[model samples]
Target: MRRLLLLPAIALITTLTLIAPTHAADQPNFLVFVGDDMTWTDAGCFGNSEVRTPHIDQLAREGMRLTACFTPAPMCSPTRQALYTGLFPVRNGAHPNHSRIHEGLRTMPHYLGDLGYRVALTGKRHFGPNESYPFEFLGKNKNPDFDAIGKFVRDAGSAPWCLMVCSNQPHTPWNRGDAEAYPPQSLTLPPYMVDTPATRKGLSQYYAEITYMDGELGRCLDILDESGQRDRTCVVFLSEQGSSFPHCKWTLYDTGIKAAGVVVWPGVVEPGTTSDALISYVDLLPTMIEAAGSTPSDEFDGRSFLKVLDGSQQQHRETIFAVQTTRGIIKGSEAYGIRCVRDGRYKYILNLNAENEFSNTVSQDGNIFASWKRKARNDPEAAELVESYVRRPEVEFYDLESDPFELNNLAADPTPAQKDRMAELRSRLNAWMAQQGDDGAATEMQALERMSPRSADGYRRWRAQQRRSGADSAD
Candidate 1:
């Protein structure tokens, strides 16, 4: 395992020089590649020698690797919406899966376009209302048209542009890269998982998909290089949200919301640099805006980390917050809502519907959870883990420095110091929700109202069916 060295109030680059903002005509180009369902720890640069991610590794070696980057929500739609809109999920009215933003919300393209830049998002768009996004759509889900990307760059000539290439790899069905490269017996499972043969097999396939996503990222980077704009382009790649494995997706665990963030700003960010500065997805657009030598608006939920990029600042945010809504997702729990807040070390989680079983598609048939249960019948360790997965306490706290995987919950018997920390974090979390107009469980039940037209209708029928079947979700 490769560990990221913690830098203490050091310069972003070796020079420790603060980069002066460039003129509007000389603004650099931006190229962003977002991978689907990839946990930060699995990123080769972050650690994990089992998977292949040469392209991502190269970026970390030549760029700044953000240690505490996170999304506003664990699911796809809310994460993407928050990233683009520069607002938290609830504030944007898209806190649920398959949800849409409020009618008049503006996004990245709008902000960047006003600054005279061509902004386009290609592939795997979970956003909606064309007016809100307004990106020049390029390709379909999972498949970004590389040729079109190259052509778009060539056609842009000297105009500064920001392009986001979204990928749909390593999500589900786990069939992308070559699984043979990673033998099931040779892999070391994360501590949170059960070491069943079925789990190993699924891990192998999931790893292959991760590598496949890296390959796609390589292609996107190659386009920038081929265009001779590599130096003038700031290349960034983010592992958007965690994988759908248990304790990863559909939860507020660090593994679920932690994003793999690497930024390669040529002549600006130092090579092989690492920053422990915490940043949220909502902060990205504001950072980009500042990078373009423009001012970010006060209405945004995030502040620009451009100073952090140029060695002018060390930390970005005081704490990061995330939410999880299970009402509209496929095979998700009826109203199991979760919220979390984390600083550098401690993480606090609140499960609003703690009485309900924490359920998701991960425990469905053919998934790894069933296999764990089968082994749990005879193995006490497996049984304990299986029980812990579905049954969680309402208030959970973990010292992230000591327990990175979050196996031990300190909330059960908190020390005086721990109790004080928890109270502070819980108070901050409540204040954040109040600002977003979130009423905890009540906000969760109204998820369909924020969903896209297509997703809203489907979930309405599903809710109706659940009612007919005597499954009262309290919706």
Candidate 2:
């Protein structure tokens, strides 16, 4: 096994400097657009010809597109918390879906506030202990108040402001966009998905929702333009995660953790350029801090990727990590937790509770997956695909180049070189777990500690309802 170069992470960032305040005028304003459950490949800029995302395509033409951005955690709450806090989900104590952060953790608003920026978030905040994420919230709906966004940007005058606008489109119950625009028979499904009529309908609806989210993103960007802040503001668009489908939302596969990112920073970033630098959601906070003339704290699991923005550096991280805690999610796996490490090419997944069958809403309750099961009776390929979604080994490895969708596993009976690579990745993953105080299955067992009281109550209520109908699925 040849030793992989631990170039970026091995050396700790030590020269962190905190400059004096009054930096509002000198620093630039920032506006971030977040989309819910949007698959990266669906965006026209990323390589989809069917799903029309004209706004995202326009942004890509005027900015740099990120080809290898991923969230540290796949679920909504964990991903949002990690992005806001600049800490991995487990370390921040928000590893589970519908979870809350550990008390006393200072998030992006705190750090950016200290740097003289009025940080605010509008729409779809799935974090908790609300104080931890102290951004001047503009609205509480799934979509942003465009009037409020415009007023906020225009009111800031010369003072630097940071606003993150989130959209709830393209999530489950995908009903936001015009399904008519995407014909069921004309759409091309990903190779991983089953091609049944139900699957096509679901995918078409998903794509429609994506187009709707793109419109939402365009609205935010349009606000900046109307406010005359477009040139001065660094606009960032992020497609949160994959849509709700089999082998996507609740797993650590690329489709689950990978995200789409585009940035437009005038005079700094080159237009129409794309980079393959790996960026984790945790890196956003420190990047914001560094961009504002302050140094990133050593405590951040991610460092500033501002250099990637400025075009000074082409690479950011040698390896990126992700967490998937199926506990506490709606129709989730009881205790199936996953951890994985990926570099430029290969990936290693450690399924902590692999003995238990993996089950989620897509596999058990969704119409699309039911179609898959129905088709499986007559289609061997559909049967194989359906079976793979719910069952897995303790270890899974993939050569991403050969398997972009992660369809094949290379962990069992691997070649000597493949074994070495897997071992090396596993070693790094173990070190990361230790650093986050993530005791694998032990950490997963304490998920209730991380889940918020409200979320837990809701889960109990749902379980009770299931019992009343004589269809209780609680284990």
TM-score of each: 0.93, 0.94
lDDT of 2 by residue, 365-466 (tens): 898999999999999999999888887889999999999999889999789999999999999999998777788998888897789887777766765675
User: Per-residue lDDT for 388-468 in model 1, tens only?
Assistant: 888888999999999999999999898999999999999999988777777899988998788876877877787688679
Q: Give the TM-score of candidate 2.
A: 0.94
How many backbone clashes can be found in candidate 2?
0
Error of 2 at 268 (Å): 0.4
* Candidate 2: segments with Cα more than 4 A from true spot: 1-17, 460-475
